[model samples]
Target: MTGPETDNESPETDDEPPEHRRYARYLELLESVQEADEAGLVAAVLRDDCVAMAESAVNRHLERRAAQLLTDAHFPDWARTTAAVIGDRAFLSRRLREWTLLRAIALDEPWTAEEVTGASDWFQRTAAAAQAVSSPEALDLLAEHGRTRRVRNAATLRLRPPRRRPG
Candidate 1:
């Protein structure tokens, strides 16, 4: 049975580029996040759609919004915690780092090498690897010393190859 199409349900036309379609949907998701009540916000954050955005300006904005949504005290603890737990599953199971999940745990704050060392939880430690490119040393520390296998694995995956020493 066909239902009336709403703005959010607009069908993609043949001419639309995939990237444009994805970005359009990403914008809609952002608007939904803003309008959603606490429960709705949590649900949106944990949705596969939110996790599926490609790395781009749209995804970066989503990460920022999702991070804020997860940490906002106005939301109920169970709601925030539920999203974080689910996001963690997504982060850990995926072959690559899920920036949205990573940013959420880090509260969208920058993680210094020292802060990564001081992180109190696995998520913090894992997200700390976002700095791996900038600070391979920090990831080296985690790869060797992280308390958990998952943290160690996450760090190891992001580490840069050791430089060759000139003979």
Candidate 2:
């Protein structure tokens, strides 16, 4: 049965660009998901719509807002710890660094202590690599390192069992 259309239920018109559509969707999600628990908010961020919005965001304000939302969202201790490690890396662009760290936290499941340590070690190595390079190359190297570290961590987390709480 058809229900009355609400403001958010309206579909995008044919003329709207995909980026604009995604941005609108992200805004809607952001409003509705604000009160969601950490896991729920992380799940929202990981949705295909949100990921597309994040990747295609051309407006600096919007991008920064989205990163702030992810950072403010409740995350597990391990994810927060890993994010702190990533945040401390030198020679990385603050925007890219924070976004990448938030993305890692969003993707994180129940993580082991060893896995968290591995992420910290990876960021440390990446920071060292950045330090070894020229200024311009350092930023590029750090960005590359961030991407590589996130990919490796995602793979590792996928293979490891989810952490169990003490009964």
The models' CA-based lDDT, in order, is 0.48, 0.40
- Which 10 residues in a row give candidate 2 its minimum summed lDDT? 1-10
- How does candidate 2 fare on TM-score? 0.28
Show where candidate 2 strays beyond 4 Å. 1-12, 38-42, 49-52, 56-167
Worst 10 residues of 1 by lDDT: 1-10
Pairs that clash in candidate 1: none
76-159 per-residue lDDT for model 2 (tens digits): 352443344334434223434434443443444232333223354444343334212223322333344434665444444433
- Write candidate 1's Cα lDDT for 53-142 as tens digits: 433423344455545544465434533444544455543223123333444333544545554555556444545455423345556767
How does each model score on TM-score? 0.32, 0.28
Among the numbered candidates, top TM-score falls to: 1
